[model samples]
Target: MRLRRRVSPLKLAVLGGVLFMLVLVVLQRDVSGGIQEPWFEDLSNRKERMLELVRGAVNNLAFQIPGQPGTPQLPAGGEVDKNCPSGFYTQAELKPWLERPPEEPHSQGAGGSAFQKDNLTPDEKKEKEEGMTRHCFNQFASDRISLHRSLGEDTRPPECVERKFRRCPPLPTTSVIIVFHNEAWSTLLRTVYSVLHTAPAILLREIILVDDASTAGGCGVYQERR
Candidate 1:
């Protein structure tokens, strides 16, 4: 006798979220001025509706998959303790990590370099594009690794680290969603983390990444560590 595989609700929810993200990625291309929420255009819109949307997505991705004991729950508001690593509920609660010192400034790098022939190996195929130049290739590349190499660490400015600049609390948390197709792994990941690091942790709720079915094969050095 053949047995049917059983799937849990949590799995189904995650699948729904992934599918939803994928759809949004496709829909975004069709919209001008980028994808925007219709309700957010007017203050008269119910804010809770947005939260409900977040709650739906959160429920899908949170908690352990199938066979797990933990269940998702909302956090009660209280005195701000620290940043919100959860990337959803606690963003409004984050204050400057004032106790920590400011980060050093990042130094700018050289002008640019095109994808050289020697750099293009058999493993990568992106260079095969007709008449592709270095400038065009670098334009699409990420500076995440370059930044780390040139700037040591903690490259944030004094204002970013100082708590004196903070506005009153009770701010709203947000979910970050990114959709891309055939994006360089390094650049795409850097974009993801740049958002995470630049924003106060408390202000972030969750980060959603959806692939738009990329076909960029590889770009030699770009793919080296992505």
Candidate 2:
């Protein structure tokens, strides 16, 4: 048998080294590129960069006050108070500081006494009635009459007046029921004002307002005559 050529150990070692280098290159391309570095590994560097950016922005916007060590500038024409470093007052903060009328000595402990005293006298009752007369006549009675008269007149064109009148159905009466649950006094009064202004007397028979379990003290006050 012919003798087979034997491979050299040196050549085999060289080939093995080349093969190992190729495998490492393939791993670096496929696995190393896909892996993300952990944030903990570079947290200190990232934090420093973020702090630098914030400090630069604040320095750009910050104004130096005269004779003050580190006071940020406020808007133009704004007043600063030593008590409030932020130089702003909320509604609650301003309410106690606002100027108000001097409280009456007689009405100090009386919650509803002022209104009750006015209702106790005959002259006061007459004055109250007179005051309410203007509101009732102008806002309610006259408005309702005007609406009724306007609807009673014919509004059809001359050409179709005769034909339309024959085919027109009778106007139906409507009752507007307003229900309020935990509604504000201003909101309830606005609803009544809107109905008085807009509703025609021919269509609207009556307006009924229903307040269901409201905690407001003056619900039925309007119903009572002076």
Candidate 3:
């Protein structure tokens, strides 16, 4: 007789969330009223709208009890502390650091307008096109931006900012895992920096990066440093 293993609820939630998002992406054109374009702009604008749906679905699944219709519940902050007292949120000096105004125009690809190819020189345009052909994205713009660049104030919602949680029972510490293959150096490093910058030090146990047989030169540099 062979034994069958039962999947954990957390694993089931993660798998279901992944499959849900994949299906949404696959049927994006049909669900989004047949809006289709080859460029990144079209997809970028609709991503937020798609994410809201995914969030709602995931949240609904997360609190589901066994053999019951999932009733979505908001996070219970009464028993656990959600906020970090020593986090960047309370640091007065660091508040301006991420959202600081740029000294020069078109510096570090600061705004949405910076991505427009209409303003690029012939040589610049050629380089960008070549980069896109090789990497399937705008490597040229990515190279110009700083790895720790500020995302500005409009990124978070007011409701999230205004919400408060209890500090009695501490929240669980988290270990972040990032996986990549042939990712650009600037973007990859930026993601690490972003996690370090935003996450509270006390709650962030460690970061584990998994490389999936990448042939890029960036991977060699990363491995050598390890």
Candidate 4:
């Protein structure tokens, strides 16, 4: 039996060139500053070595196989998807940022009309004023009555009057989970900042984020910011 010859130099060179181009396509999608510089340099050097190795292997394989051809070279200037890894987002994936929820308007005094104040009739204005006054008084009365009730009536006051009310212990902490399909970087960051600023540090435990299969590159920006 005759032993088959290895791949030829021509085939090996072609395979090597193809691998180099693949590396370039991969690098073009990188946007982060820190990763781009070092990644490009490393990829360039590694690609050179990879091309040589692939070329040699292809040549050897070509010789061994009677009719096997080397790997085909990809066309130049072709586009490649450089979106974030499997769990990450791509630019196109997060093209449109999520619309913000409408803001809650500032509350007016109870006596103020919901609509324009000028639209109210004299009778309506009088009713609103009376209603506001009653509401204020009720609140004030409740607080005062509670304070008085807490201090029981005693003919002779003890050195330390017995306090009747028992204060409740603190409640358990809670976690808020926000699920987004394809949220924008700005909106996501704003949400995080709002939570951090407003939520009581002791009461808030952790914020769990669940992604619902959003295909976007903005996820990378979110991660880097975090």
Worst 10-residue lDDT window for candidate 4 reads 143-152
Off by over 4 Å in 2: 1-167, 219-226
TM-score of each: 0.34, 0.24, 0.48, 0.25
lDDT string for model 2 (1-226, tens) is: 9999999999999999899667555554544455445643354345457769998766543332222333355446876554435522233322321232333434312222222232337865565455356333222222112111112235678864332110012224578899986554433564665566455444567889887887745544332111
Cα RMSD, model 1: 20.4
lDDT of 4 by residue, 44-76 (tens): 667668879999987655532323575232335
**Tens-digit lDDT track for model 3 on 69-90?**
5533335663423442322223
Better by TM-score, candidate 4 or 1 = 1
Ranking by TM-score: 3, 1, 4, 2
lDDT of 1 by residue, 1-226 (tens): 9999999999999999999767554554434344466643332234346758988777554352332334333356744435533323333445422223333343233123222334655534454443235334553334323422222345579864442222222345788899987665566665665565466676678889887786666645643222
**Winner on lDDT (1 vs 4):** 1
Instruction: List candidate 1 segments past 4 Å from native.
Output: 1-135, 139-144, 147-169, 216-226
- Relative to the true structure, how large is the alpha-carbon lDDT of every model? 0.49, 0.46, 0.61, 0.47
Name the lDDT of candidate 3. Answer: 0.61
- In candidate 1, clashing pairs total 12
Cα error of candidate 3 at position 198, Å: 1.1
